[model samples]
Target: MLPYACAWIAKSKGFGKPRREGGFDNHDPRAWLSRLTDWQARANAAQANSFEALPFFIGAVIIAHQLAAQQAVLDILALLFVTLRVIYIAMYVAGLPTVRSAIWALALLVNVGILFLGWR
Candidate 1:
C-alpha cells in the first residue's frame, strides 16, 4: 500500500515517468524528501526494496508460528504486523523520523511477540 501510494504521489508530482518514456517517475517520499536531488532516486529504490520485504516478513512470521503449532497467535500476529507496517509507511511519508523509528521498533516487537507468544 505504501509503495503504491508513493508511486501515485510520484506520478501526481510529475517526478515519475514521462508518457513518452518506458521508465517510471519517482513518486516515493524519499524522492521528494531528498530535496529533489539524486538521493531521491536512491531513496525511492530503497523504499521499493523495503516494501517488497514486508510481505515476506509477515508470511515468515506466520509460518514460524504455525510450525510451532500456534495457529491462533499467528492470526493475531499477522494483523498486528500489517497494522504496524501501515503506520511505519505513514510515518515515512510524513517525514516523522522519530515516529518512524518507533514504528519500526514496534514492528520488530510484533515479530518477536509472534515467536515468544507462540512458545507459551
Candidate 2:
C-alpha cells in the first residue's frame, strides 16, 4: 500500500497537468506513466514488484497460521519481512539494483521457509 501510494504521488507529481479537462483524458495513460523520472520511475517499479509479492506473502502467513506454526517463528519472520520490504523500497528508490534484488530474494526465501515450516 505504501509503495502504491508512493507511485501514485510520483505519477501525479511527474505529470503536472492533464491535456484534457474531463475525468478521462484523450492522452494515453501509458504516455503519462512513462514520463516519470529518477526516483519516481523507481517508485513505480517498486510498487509493481510489491504488488507481485503480495500474494505469496499473504498465502505464506495464512498457511502458517492455519498449520499452527510456531508463534515466535512466525512473529520473527513477519518482522523480518516487513523490515526487508522497507529496505527493499529504499534500495529500489536509491537505484541499488543488486542489493534490492538480493533483499527481494531473501524475502522470497523467508516466505517459502514459512510455508515449508508450517507444513512440517
Candidate 3:
C-alpha cells in the first residue's frame, strides 16, 4: 500500500509538460518517472522494491500462522520487518546503497526465518 502510494507520489513529482505543448501531452507518466534522476529515481526504485518484497513477507506470515508458530514471536518479527523496511526506504532516498542493501538483506532474512520457524 505504502509502496503504491510512493509510486504515485513519485509520478506526481516527476510530472511535467513540454513548454511548447498544449494543456497536456500524451507522454507516458511512467516514461517521465523513468527519466527522473537522483533522489526521485531512488524513491521510485524503493517503491519497486517495496512491491517486490511484499509477497515473501505476506507468505511468511500466512505460513507461520498456518503452522501455529508462537504469536509473540510472529508479532516481534513482523514489527522488526516493518521497522527495517522503513529504514530501508530512508536509506534508499538518502542514496546510501550499502546500508539500504544491508537492510534489505536483513528483511529477507527475517522472512526466511519466519518460514523456517513455520516449517519446524
Per-model TM values vs. the true structure: 0.60, 0.80, 0.83
Q: What are the per-residue Cα lDDT tens digits for candidate 3 across 1-120?
A: 759765765555434645244212235656666677788788889899899999999999999999999989999998899889988998998999999999999988988888777666
lDDT of 1 by residue, 1-120 (tens): 656665554344444456345234344534444444343343354367458757767667766766684677677886888788777766666667798789888887887766566554
lDDT values for all models: 0.62, 0.78, 0.80
- Model 3, residue 92: distance off in Å is 0.5
Error of 1 at 34 (Å): 8.2
* Weakest ten-residue segment in model 3 by summed lDDT: 17-26
Candidate 1 versus the native: TM-score?
Answer: 0.60
Winning model by TM-score: 3
Error of 1 at 1 (Å): 4.9
Q: Between prediction 2 and prediction 3, which has the larger lDDT?
A: 3
Give the distance in Å from residue 21's predicted Cα in candidate 1 to where it truly belongs: 13
Q: Report the C-alpha lDDT of model 2 over 19-60, residue by residue, as the tens digit.
A: 553222235756665666798789878888888888888889
Superposition-based RMSD of candidate 1 using all C-alpha atoms, in angstroms? 5.6
What's model 3's TM-score?
A: 0.83
